[model samples]
Target: MMNRFICIPLCLFLLSVCNPKKNERPNGWYYITDRVEDSISLEPIVTINDFEEIKLDSAENLKGKFIYQITGHVAADCVEKWADATEHSIGKRIGFVFQDEVICTPCINCRIETGSFAISAQDTDIKSIYWQIVRKIHSR
Candidate 1:
């Protein structure tokens, strides 16, 4: 079952905390700001950059398939689109880009009121971007 998100400010926390296996993150992951663009307009919106790296944890939740988890300080505005399924929610999708490349265009699933989420790719295309995040982590 999915959990409902409750917002609290002033705390730098993650909803789900799972360390990467052996503390080793694979290639192509990245760290980015939550300031997302409207999927349609592509206009920028000021958003929270409170989160950290997104990693592939386990496949159990995904029918034994691997998926990337975006865990860290989630921002309220980042997930507002998934809070309800109203007219605004209708036909709404969350678009993510890494250095001008599209990461995901997932349909609004649920409110990420907490500060963590996972992205499951229909194809292995995300593998390419995973290394970008790995490089970002290593450079730090």
Candidate 2:
């Protein structure tokens, strides 16, 4: 009886500690931001961890597509943020940032509600860029 009581409380405490707040960013995750700080975008509206998968696919014009699927546990919050940001910043640029670098900047056109999105890659070496992002996220 004594062990059960202690264990239940301990489990509850651990669960609470592991539950990340909606505003918290996972370690080394990339985020979307509208503003740049110290020449780099720092504030996180949504993070890479919110996405289920990020992939690189071939496209026309010698470019590649950086496709993302926002279908994980944080999908609701992630979709909300994305829609809000894009809605507010129509015709303005938003950035994808990791650490101190702005990895990609794309102008918002309209409110995006779809869970999937793709950004065109400027580099021809799409495979390398894809691996680089994967490595960066894992290196955290």
Candidate 3:
């Protein structure tokens, strides 16, 4: 009986130390901003009948000066894009936009069905121009 009690406490302690709960914002709209440095634009150059790899240009790197904004929806029933499909309840929907350009915009829809969520934007060159994420948004 005493051994069983000690084992339970030890297991609980180990679990607590090993795995900690992640932090999540309250159920509401939130803004996430970050600037990607040394990132290249993955725009496609030309249209080819056959499969061709796209090239990227690394001319300008975004320093901390560049600011990007994401309008995030925390609730599940906020907006419905497709019919006959259940909207994501726990995960949030984020729309990305650059603060300076205002006109030029690249919005990506992201979600975490099981694990981490990542968003990447490709240009005409089919190269990845921008990438961001809401890290570890879900738990098992």
Candidate 4:
């Protein structure tokens, strides 16, 4: 009986020591400028400039039917140039430069995708542009 009691305590101790949970951070992306000034821990993995080429993921069965909503502060110079060049409004246009080219990939529970859009304005200097990409999940 005494041996059985000791064994139970030892097994419990060993089980506790053997299994540990992992430290998981939030899953998402953010666009920031001046990595040090932003007080943000996540470093920017990608950078974009005017007229740069960006690639987006493609979705299956939902191709060309998804809606993208983009919102961010654009540099004043970019607004002026876009106003003169395109019919898109600088104040409300999202995915203006990279429209119709985003690609979606199958994720664990849903699809994940990302794309970069260019802002063109000769005189505007934008400090940072924050954007998010969300896809409509279809029930299977």
Candidate 5:
């Protein structure tokens, strides 16, 4: 009977150690401002934690096809940094990376100042990626 009681607590402890807690810090996700051929910058302009909130949703594109949108709200303290990066990156290619893997390299079309950013992708499964990112943002 004593062994059974000890085993129950031991199993619970093992489960807690093995499972990822919701509040745990997530792995690295980066915004790359520079890239050369297949290699991206080792220094990230911003990390996923810079965002206060991140969400995942689907929307219809001009072609009437459904696509995924991952929208983020820059933390107030990081708004200046985010704005400057976007402004300087206009008409230039930038990248989003997760765990050293390139997620997307899109050209910035304009300067964004609203403290919000949206990343939209077509012909890809963004749902999984979005969830991974959203799980990292504490305010999400």
Candidate 6:
């Protein structure tokens, strides 16, 4: 009887230890200024804590379409420069990568700025990718 009682508590402890909480930091992509020395180079501009909320949802009136939305405010300090960079970044690939092996690349066509942003890919499953991103980042 005592062994059974101890085993239950032990199992609970194991579960708690195994399922640790996720970090407060979020992992995702952002737009940044393009730099040039002799040649133009695309630089990933990071906005710290840019995402106030991230969510998964189905596209309205678009059957079988899924979207991931990020809502936040843009940097008020660099509006014009940010706008220019965003325009330059169109038709480019969007990514959030820590290393070569770990990354998420989403299709991007429009500018990234303040307010709400949504990402969806016709060639790839963004919902699946989004979940993978959440798991990969939250697991750390």
Q: Per-candidate TM vs. native?
A: 0.42, 0.52, 0.22, 0.24, 0.63, 0.37
List runs of model 3 lying over 4 Å from the truth: 35-140
Cα RMSDs of all predictions? 20.3, 11.9, 16.3, 16.5, 8.3, 11.5
Ten-residue stretch with the least lDDT total in model 1: 23-32
Candidate 4: regions farther than 4 A off:
30-140
TM-score sort, best first: 5, 2, 1, 6, 4, 3
TM-score winner between 3 and 4, please give it.
4
lDDT of 5 by residue, 1-140 (tens): 99999999999999999996543223333344444643555556677877777788787879997788787787898888777877888887667666555667777887777767766656556788777777766454
How badly does each model clash, as a count of residue pairs?
A: 11, 0, 7, 7, 0, 0
Comparison by lDDT, 3 against 5, better one: 5
| Every candidate's lDDT | 0.42, 0.56, 0.29, 0.30, 0.69, 0.49
Model 3: worst 10 consecutive residues (lDDT sum): 44-53
What would the TM-score be for candidate 4 when compared with the true structure?
A: 0.24
What lDDT tens digits, residue by residue, belong to model 3 across residues 65-84?
Answer: 32332223222332232111
- Deviating ranges (above 4 Å) for candidate 2: 1-41, 60-74, 123-126, 132-140
Which candidate tops TM-score? 5
Residue by residue across 1-140, what tens digits does model 4's lDDT show?
99999999999999999987543323222222234743222422221232123223323345554332222222343444333322222222222211222121111221112222333332222211112222211111
Q: Where does model 6 exceed 4 Å of error?
A: 1-42, 47-52, 60-115
For model 2, what is the error of residue 93's alpha carbon versus the real structure, in angstroms, after optimal superposition?
A: 0.3
Which of the two candidates, 1 or 2, achieves a greater TM-score against the reference?
2
Candidate 1 local Cα displacement, residue 106, angstroms:
1.7
Lowest lDDT sum, 10 consecutive residues, model 4, at 103-112
